[model samples]
Structure formats: C-alpha cells, structure tokens
Target: MQLKSLRMLEAVCDTGSFGAAAQLLHTVQSNVTAHVKKLEEETGAQLLERASPVHPTPAGRLLLEHARHMLRTHDLALAQLQGLDPQGASQVAGTLRIGSMETTAALRLPVLLAQLRRQHPGIDLELEAQPTAALLEALMAGRIDCAFVNGAAPHSGLQSWPVFREELVLVSGQPLTRFPTPQEFCASVFLAFRQGCSYRQRVELLMASQGVTAVRIMELGMLDTILGCVAAGMGYALLSRALVEAQQQRFGVHWISLPPGLAEEFAWVDTCFVTGSVAGWSPALRAFAQLLGIHAQAIAAGEHVRPGPAQRVHRRQAEPMPA
Candidate 1:
C-alpha cells in the first residue's frame, strides 16, 4: 500500500471524517475517499467504514498505528540526515511546520514569525492555524512537526509540556459589576462553540458539581460568532483572556472573573497522542520558544496573558485589575 494512502488513512481515523482529513491534507474529499478505497482493496479487508465522515475498521486501526510510526521514523531519519549536513544549515534550512488554534494564529505568531524569519531566514515556515480538535489530529497524524495548542494536556499517548496557567474568564458584552454567582450565571444565556469545546466542557462540569441544572446554552459555529453574539448582548462565554482581548476592539467584548477558583492549564504539544511518536523534535523548538519574548509569546500563542498585580493593563471600562 502506498505510504501516502496510509497517511490519508491515519488522518481519516484521527479526524473521523473523510472530508476533514482531505481538508487537513489540502486535497479534495473525493480523492481521500478514493485513496482509502484503494488501500482497503489492497489490504483485502475493510480499512475504513463508509459513513458520514468515516471511521477505521479493526484492520484500518492497525495499519494506521504502523503508518504513524513509519512517518515519524521517516521524519527523524530525515532530521538526522539534515543534521549531518549541519554545515549548510548551521543556517537552519528546510520547512518548519507550526500548528496552532485560530486565536493563536491571529494573536501570537505575528511577533514570533517576524523574529523567526529574521533569525532563521533560510527556513521556510508554514503556519497551520486550526481548531484544537483538528490540530490534535494533524499532530498525531504526523501532518505537523510541532504545535502550540490550548486545553488540558490530553490524557492520551502524547507528552505535554506545561507552559502556562490560563484562568478561565467569563466574558460578557454587558457590564458585569460583580463576578456572577454560579446560580445567577447558570441562569444567564451561555454562548459557546459546538459540542467538543474545552471551555464549554469546563463550564458544564463546574455547573454540574454545583447542582446547577438546565443551563441556557446556545451553540455558535465559530469563536468569532460566539464573541460577536456576546458583544451584541446575546450571552456570555468562558475563554482565555488573550482570545477575548485579541478581538476586543472589533467584537467589543470584555472579561470578568469566574465565580472564584477556576483555571485551566495548557501547553505546547510536541508529539502526537495516538501515534505515540515525536516526529523529529529537537532542541530547536524550545530554543525558538526562548527566542520569543515570554508574555509576548504567550499572548501570541493564545495562552492566557498573565499580568502581575503591579503590571496589569485593563482594557474594559473599569479600573485596572490583576489579570
């Protein structure tokens, strides 16, 4: 079977959608379907299930596991070979792939890229801005070399590096004179992304533990939509402060504290989870991270912008408070 087909298979399994896999691979959906069908025929068993999107069969899963390993090994060997030619890239050549969520792409990487190009002029850096779910899939499928993502360090097969502690903020378009008590907030309209949103999960879980029932939640397809709805006085949302601030001017939203004690830990994922392989990771990622200014990088990478008690900058129409 073609390794390219296997790559397609891995992506389909990770994303659970032929169309999504094709989109991530920057190819047509029909081609992804055709490639998988061909691979299944070669394997003499069903490699993928035919359904909305798609799923991997038992045989398909096994092949995907192996394919992930093969691609990772290929990358490492390439890196080693490239390293052998260090003479040429004591100058840092070749494609550098970075994956991240939309807010991070919109907020953080501009500074990082500006400086990255200046420092690693020989490298061709490709920026892939995706949602957290898709980023995780591409990471595991070996589609991206490394990525900075938000959410809990997933309890999957990947290794996570804790980079920052992001407090969850309750965002509202209307003035929140005080942090809404859990019950009051739960009664208010809740705006969020679709089913798999991490912030949505966090808020729901918190409410569940506190015995709040029948939440008034409305789902919007995109972050911008959710924020726009909130800014137009539709509902409140929970998210990292950086994201809220990133579009604060355009969307006209502001953040208020969660009830009291609540936050989420996030990190930059270097390895793919299900693939269980770190493709060609080196000291370079960390080194490049260091080259970036910390708060600047954190904000750019869509991590919560941490402002100390003395250094806080408040954009909301209120006195500056600690971020």
Candidate 2:
C-alpha cells in the first residue's frame, strides 16, 4: 500500500470520521474515501465500520499500529538526512509536538519557549497540557515528540532528562500553626487535579503517611479552580511551593512547609524532559534538547540564574528526585 493511503487511514482513525479526516489532511472526502477503500482492498479486510464516529475494525487496528511505526521511521529518516546539510542544521524547521503538565506549561515553559522562538523561527511548536500519565501515553502513541512530566521516565523505550526540581507544599485556606494530626487530616477534604496527575498521587501518599487511610478528594481540572476552592475552605491541595506562593496574593491561600523528612519523601519532585529514544529524535527535538541542556548547565554553574517562581530549583545538580 502507498504511504499516502496509510496516512489517510491513520487520519480517519484519529478523527473518527471520513469527512473529518479529509479536513485534517486538507483533502476532499472523496480522496480520503478512495485511499481508505484502496487500503481495504489491498489488505482484504473491512478496515472500518460504517457508523457515526466511525471506529477501526480489528484488522484496521493491527495495521494502524504498523502504519504508525512506518510513518514515524520515515519522518525521522527524512529529518535526519535533511539535517546533514550545513544550511539545514542552522535552519532546522518542523512541527514539534510537545506535551507537558499544566503546572509546567504555566510556570516553566514561557521563557524557554520564547528563547526557542527567537533561535529557531522556522520551528512550529504545538504544546499540549495534560497530566503525566496522558502525556506518557501520547508519547508512546507517536502523538507527541517529547514531554515534560513529573518524575523520571518509566518505560525502557523512553529516555529522560531531569530539567527542573520543585518543592511541593501543603496548601489550605487558613494558616496552620503546626502539622495536622491524622484525625484532623481525615476530617478535611482535599482538592487536586484529576486522577492521572502525579501531585494527586502525592496528596494520597502524604495523607497515608499521617496514618489516614480513607480521604475525600475532589478532582478539579484547572489550577486556578483548585486554588480558589482551597482559599474558600473547600479543601487542601498539594502543589509546588513556588506555584502556590506566586498565586498566594491573588488567591489568598496559605501554604505550609512539610516537615524536612516528609518534604524529602513526598515534597520534592523532578520535572523531566522525556522522549521516545535518542535514535529517533528529530532535528527540531535535538535543538530543543540542546537548549534545555544549556539551561541545565547554567543552573549547575550558578550563572545567570533567575531566582523566582518561574525558575524554582530545589537542588543545584538537577538530579532526579527520589521516587
């Protein structure tokens, strides 16, 4: 089958409708239909079910997996060969799909992305904010080129670079003179991002450490909403100290520092830059990694360091936080 046909099939699977896939591929519906029909005939299987929000059949799912692999390999090879030219190396240009946690997207990415825009104007960057689990899933599915996620990479197919270390704090509506007892914690409600968030997991672990088991957690999507509810005495939340402190003035929320031991255990987390593998990195991705490496080196040398909510570094070495 032709690569164009496979691309049309992938688009249909992604968009879930022939017309929508045509729009996504910037082609007509008839072309998308013809390409899909060609694939079905070549494979001798009904690839898609005829229904609203169409779905791939069993055979289509199988071929889609291999199609994705082939497409990724082809793209990487083209990018690498283009970069071999001196002019192309300086003018690296491609769509770089990056996934990041909402917190990182808010606090960390602005300055870095600004620098990237200045250095490589040709690069088209698409940034998606999601929880760590979803970001990792997208990375493995070839939906994103790289991701900034909490903690180190978990899968053997991925490689991670420790980019930032954040100190988490316990936030509440009122000031706490001391740590709450297990009973006190159990009696309170907690607000956090949805289930896949790493910070939400930390909230559970922190409560369990206080010998509190069954805790009530309200899942919210936005950072502002969580802080707003916390300020209104809705519940407590575990968030980066820098993030909380930055918004404390507006939200009027109070954050308590965790005990040194607990801080070491659950408060410190590394925001890592994870990618599929070094071998598969595109020129644009390599350029982005180089920028991150420079920033990490600057942090290591304690030079040109901007100390504020945006660039909070708990440790100078940029090591991965304990799991």
Candidate 3:
C-alpha cells in the first residue's frame, strides 16, 4: 500500500471516523474511505470495525504501530535535510509539541516560550498541560516531542536534563502555627490534581510521614480550583511555594514550610525536560533544549531569573511560615 494509504489509516484510527479523519487530513470523506479500503484489500484483512465511532481491529492496530514509525522517520529525515542547508541554518522550522505539568506550564514556560518565539520565529509550538505522569506517557507514546516532568527520566529509552527546582509547601486557608498531628491531618481533606500528578503522590507521602495511614484526597483538575478550594477551607493542598505564592493574594491562601527531613525527602523536587534518545530530536527540540540549558545555568549561578508577566505578583497578602 502507498504511504498515503497508511496515513489515511492512521488518521482514521486517531479520529475514530472516516469523516473526522477527512477533516483532520484536509481531504474529502470519499478519499479517506477509498484509501482505507485500498489498504484492507492489499493486506487481505479487515482493518477497522465499521461502527459509529470506528475502532482499529487487531490487524489494524499492528499496522498502525508500524505506520507511526514510518511517518516519524520520514518527518525526521525531512527536518534533518532542511537543517543541513546553510541558508536555512538560522531559521530552523518545524512543529515542536511539548507536554508539561500544569504548575510548570503556569509558572515556568511563559518566559521561555516568549524567548523561543522571538529567537526562532519559524518554529510552531504546541503546548499541552498535564500532570507529570501523563506528560511522561505522552512523550513515550510519541504524542509529544518533549516534556517538562517532575523528575529525571524513569525509562531507559528516555533522556532528561534538570531544568527547574521547586520547593514544596503545605497550603491551607488558615495560618499554620506548627506541624499538624496525625489525627489533625487525617481530619482534613487533601486537594490535588488527578491520580497521575506527581504533586498528588507527594501529598500521600506527606500524610504517611505524619503517621497517618488513611487519608481523604479530593481530585481536582485545575491549579486555580485547588487553590480556591484551599482558600475556602474545603481542604489542604501541597504545592510549590513559587506557584502558591504567585496567587496567594488572589486566592487568600497560606502556606507553611515542611519539616527539614520531610522537605529533603519529599518536598524538594527537580522539574526535568525529558525526551526520547538524542537521535530522535528535531532542530526545534534542540533549540528549545539549548534555551532551557542556558536558563538552568543562570539559575545555578544564583542569578535572579525573572518570572514572566503571568507569574509576576504585584503584592503578597500572606507569607509562607516556618513549620
């Protein structure tokens, strides 16, 4: 079958319908149907289940895995060849898909992205905000080119660079005079992002450290929502000090430092930029990584890294307490 046919098959599976795939591929439904039929005829096996929302049959799923590899190889080859042209060296152009944790996306990426746009106008950037676990999965599945995740790469196939450091704090509506006892902590609800969030995992660990075996956790999707709930005294949340302080005034929330041992063990975290093997990186990805490297270096040197406009706070109504 032709590469175009494989592409059509992949699109159909991705969009779950012939018409939707046509829309995504910028083609007519008839063309998509013809291409899919051609692939099935060539392979002598049914590829898709003709349902309302179509699904790939077992045979189709196997072919789709190979199709993605072929497509990625073709795209990477084109990008590399373009990069070799001396005339185009200054203007690296490609779509760079990035995945990041919501907190990082909110607090860290704005300045970096602004710099990237000014330096490389040809690069098209797409950013997706998810939890660290989701971002890692997206990176491995090829849905995203790189990710700003919680820690170093956990899988052997991936590589990572430490890009940012975060100090975690316990947030609440009321000021904390001292560390809460296990009984007190158990009586409170913990608000966090959905199950896959790294911060959510830290909340559990923090509770366990307090000798609390069972605790209640409320899963919320947005950072603002979690903060708002905390401000309303609905629950407590564990978040980065930078992130919480950025919106403390608006949310009327307070935060306290964790005990030194707990902070060292669970509260201090490195947000890493992770990607597949170096061989798979596109020029756009390389450029972004270089910028992050420079930022990391500046941070290491104890220079003041300015926050982007979105992160800047004009005034703070509350300050973090030492617990």
Q: Which is the leading candidate under lDDT?
A: 2
Task: Give the residue spans of candidate 3 off by over 4 A.
Answer: 1-89, 303-323
Better of 1 and 2 by TM-score: 2
Identify the superior model by lDDT, candidate 2 or candidate 3: 2
lDDT per residue as tens, model 2, 121-208 = 8788999999999999999999999999997778989888777767788899999888777788888889988988999998889888
Worst 10 residues of 2 by lDDT: 314-323
User: Taking the candidates one at a time, how many backbone clashes does each contain?
Assistant: 1, 0, 0
Q: Residue pairs in steric clash, candidate 2? A: none
Tens-place lDDT digits, model 1, residues 1-323: 78788888888988989888999999999998899889878888998887866777788888888999997777655654454233333444566678865555665568777787787665678878666677777878878766666533364655444333345677899878887666776668788766655556666876665567667789886778888899998878877666677678898888876543333222112111121234544434433545543544354367444533322221121221112
For model 1 the TM-score comes to: 0.55
Full candidate order by lDDT, most accurate first: 2, 3, 1
Alpha carbon lDDT of each predicted model: 0.64, 0.84, 0.83
Off by over 4 Å in 2: 1-89, 299-323
Error of 2 at 174 (Å): 1.7
